[model samples]
Target: MRHYYIYLLKPEIASNYFGKEWLIYQLFVEGETAKKDLRTIAQKQINYISGTIPTLQIKKNLDKALRIRNDFYVLKEHYYIDIKALESKAVLKDHGNMLTISASGSYQAETVFFEVLRQINPAFFAMDFENRNYGWLNPVKQVNYI
Candidate 1:
């Protein structure tokens, strides 16, 4: 079943990787939420099945990091449609949980997610990849547990 899982980024990693003291990734996964899958998804920003990230967030800085920048823009409208679908379903709660991003929140969770991707300098991202020890550790929250 598809659900949400919150992975807390390690403090130092959060600082160095995302330039933030505290960062959490609340991911929507359809299968078993493995750290490996989370790391891969977070690192690549590409959809697990479709192998693509939403194109709207890409900019010059992030563009430089992508191997195929042109590929992103091809499906820009599809993602917005997906977001609208999510909004219609009320998949992202707007009221109860402060931790959850509201459907109408100025900073959508997906934006923060991609922003985290953009925050890392290409050089640092490359060096860190060599270590194979990413910051996405144990999940702090899971819908099943909660």
Candidate 2:
């Protein structure tokens, strides 16, 4: 079994025109080093998925950490697609802005997941095989013969 993870990056800083708080939604997909630079893969994912991008309102003196909560809402909504597909057959770990999903099956599922993530944001992505524990912790579990 192989696992694929996705992390959404929220805007860390905002401009004065936006009142020092701007929310940018980015998607990070795990695995498949070769297709990461491809743009068509992302477009295909969007054509298949259903959802709207979330909106945020920033208030004065709001703590930067608070923005994470808002980002979770967006993540939660996006995560549902995978949840519906895998159901209890997979394990899911939510670490604020990051989500780790694991399932038992061929690598095709991972490819599809990556496509979806790319569809969300082609600019935000990182791949790691060794340093998986450094950032946010979100894990999903699955079982299958690989």
Candidate 3:
């Protein structure tokens, strides 16, 4: 069985800054050898996750975080989880890994899940959150690779 590292980010308290508010980020690292490239993998992952921001300071911090370690920190308002995907159902080999984002209120929880649909897939997209009643009634937004 292939090995994978699953990371999850959950918000401590939901805010109204961005629509539904809950903000979370997850990453999956595959292969036994993939751990050796964690830093590079993390850099690519962060860049892919952060979207395009017009400022250099944010970019620098993102780069710095990725280059340094496996365990990185977000703001004080979020939570994180890093686990090994061991079972078939537990692992989403298609997109990379699964990321679940949850918020604190009644606005419907936004879950941005991902998987490696194909072993050599080039892009990423968001799957539905596990629970639909936590935030908005509409479908979760699809975030494609930039």
Candidate 4:
């Protein structure tokens, strides 16, 4: 089976465009064959999923995320999985991986949920006392990269 890497938009960046509930983005094949480069593969996947962005306002938000000029910001993390594994998990659909738990109902959800436990807020939150440990107290912005 072919090996692949699925890159997901960071939750913070995605929240700006999609909102809090959205998590996984799509599947991107790891290697190059023929003339298709990795960047080309990424762009193709992005264009395919672009359909999910309906409103001009949301599109503008997505564009803002892209403008950061960091591939790390745009597509922050990746998962390495084999084709057979993905197929068995039922996440492989129409050449893309359906990333959400409701969409896939598979192991991907477990992976994401586990990561959320470690995530800290990007900015300070004055409303909650828990903020003392996560947001401002933590000098480094915590994001899900696992």
Best by TM-score: 2
- lDDT of every predicted structure (CA atoms): 0.29, 0.32, 0.29, 0.29
TM-scores, all models, native as reference: 0.19, 0.30, 0.18, 0.19
Local lDDT at 132 for model 1 = 25
Order of candidate numbers by TM-score, starting with the best: 2, 1, 4, 3
TM-score result, candidate 2: 0.30
Kindly indicate the candidate among 2 and 3 with the higher lDDT: 2
RMSD of each: 16.9, 17.7, 16.3, 18.2
Q: Quote the positional error of residue 27 for candidate 3 in Å.
A: 3.9
Please give, for residues 1-146, the per-residue lDDT of candidate 3 as tens digits.
22222232122111221243233222322221246677577656544443321224323433453335333234442322232232112212222233234333222111111211111121223323333122221323444578
lDDT of 4 by residue, 14-131 (tens): 3443322222222222222324676687666554443331223322433443344322122232222122444322111122322221123344432332233123222211111122
| Candidate 1, position 54, lDDT | 25
Candidate 4: which pairs clash?
none
Where does model 3 exceed 4 Å of error? 1-26, 29-33, 51-146
lDDT for model 4, on a 0 to 1 scale? 0.29
Lowest summed lDDT over 10 consecutive residues: which window, candidate 3?
A: 111-120
| Candidate 2 runs further than 4 Å off | 9-94, 126-146
How many angstroms is residue 68 displaced in model 3 relative to the true structure, after the best TM-score fit?
Answer: 40
